[model samples]
Target chain A: SYYEKVGFRGVEEKKSLEILLKENPLDLEKLSTFSQRFPLPSMYRIHVWKVLLGILPPHSDSHALVGGYRKEQYNDILEALHVMRYVNCSTPFTDVCLRMFQLESQVLPRCSETTGPDEENEDFLSIARSMEEIVDDPIDCYWLIKCFVHQFHAKFGDSIPHLPKSLEHYLSQEEPRLLRHLKNTDALAQLPYGLWFRRCFAGCLPESSLCRVWDKVISGSCKVLVFVALEILLSYNNVLLGISRPEGVAKLLCNIPQENTDAIVTKAIDSWHKYCGTPMHAV
Target chain B: FLEDVKCQAKAELQSSDGRYQAQRRITQLLQTELLQLYSRVETEAPAGTASGSPPGGRADSYP
Candidate 1:
């Protein structure tokens, strides 16, 4: 009975997605709008992500060929990197890349043929812990992370494109008092936004809410991240205001328990609608 | 080919049958809660001023 009542909505959403997927030259605009509005059915999420992220082309006919080509390219890159890692330990790659490469080797059965015993990547568990449940297949996860890095410029470092400055801009407009308090206490400067922006809130939010926020990001622009970040700070404004120490503020903001998903994301989406066309092009 | 992929995925979704019943239940429950929250927020908020937070004192009104 509960399933009959609640499952209908998800089923309807799935049907709509199916219709969109069946379109010949798939109407990307409509699909984006669809993804922006409704929850993506779990069954079709990877394919929809592939299409939206341009890993698979828009033309339905090209799906198989392009998917094959991209997977091969991914494997070839891994094999090359595997060789290089052995030859030169100084080769530069992000921790995410090294972790994903090691994870891929473990997951793909054939990888044992080429991939040598990499020093265990214990660091990825801390970084991408949430990804374990959301995406089962490491190959899909690898490509998704690669495309995310390309699309979102998700490099973890001091220089996130539009960071505390854009965050300050939104804060001034939405929560001026909170902004003033953060500045007065020097709390804003200490927030770990680089990690948040770099990973696109992968570990911060639960899988469902993260997926919803990411749907908006994929549909619209990376600017959506700013709105999500702002909404999050605003959500915890009261807690933040009472704290004067930078460490306390940073600690509290970093670990928002995975509750209130709808309210946060809904407000973020509202913010996106209101301010999307403005000059927030720091991406 | 995309159609075929979709068909295969749909079939997989069906084939799981009762195996994924527990996961599906959790997802449905979460989805229902989310829909309820969406409608409540939608009804309370005004027509425009989307950038402004909801009129409530708390930002998210999580309670």
Candidate 2:
């Protein structure tokens, strides 16, 4: 029933439609390159590209565009798309974002045809609409990231002997930076749901660790900010996963056992209340 | 706050040979126990389907 609501009933058809929507009439070279690099059953590259385009400056070059697409953002969009396809039991928005990304990445560089006023307006309006929808919910992005990280740790933990040294260094540095962003009340509160999760959860950490980190962050003095942030994250999770806030959080915290739930919930509430006591709340 | 906890936990986990082994066990135990309690609330929470549809009912869903 829930899956039906998110347009999961005909995933193959939907996916095919996404493929068609992503079909570009120009720049076959870039399109072919994208296809060759990401040989998956789904349009993961397209989704990542959509997020990149959405955030990238309109005038940025290909090198700048790729450079601006942070590893965290790429992983976040990838994970979000994965969850949308498999776990969340929905794929339409993911498909749309993927299409947007694909269009931006593939079409933007080579097209000589100027975007007509109506088309430009439509694109802006679509982006704004998507942003509004994503910002309205929070948990989806968190769950997407949580699931992504969990699966990654499971697949790669202590087994992948040939991991690139660059990746290792990147992980060591980037993971903390992303986590710190999530912990920042002012910063996290400002991000759209998709970007927030991409920036925070799509990295090389144990899902258990991520949840623990999130819990600790939530428990600190900025609880209201964290709670509101978590609320947004959970809302996004619910959308993607076909679960509710508590359900999504429950799943995210699945690695945590029952006895600690009370402690964690109490800590979260206390932190939120404490945060509410601030001058920021008075305004 | 997480960094602080992580630092403390990492330190605690690394303090003793036995504790290091136990850290993995404890974190797992804590996660499982806490999640069971939290799951009950998840079922009742509202679903966050995006508003509006673009023809064939493609609404963005997350989890």
User: Which candidate should be chosen as best, given DockQ against the real structure?
Assistant: 2
Residue-wise C-alpha lDDT for candidate 2, range A90-179, written one tens digit per residue: 444433343334433454222223234443234333333333333323323332323333333344334323322322233234244433
* Fnat for the candidates in order: 0.00, 0.05
User: If scored against the real structure, what TM-score would every candidate get?
Assistant: 0.61, 0.18
| lDDT, candidate 1, at A248 | 95
TM-score of chain A of each: 0.73, 0.19
Listed models, DockQ each: 0.01, 0.03
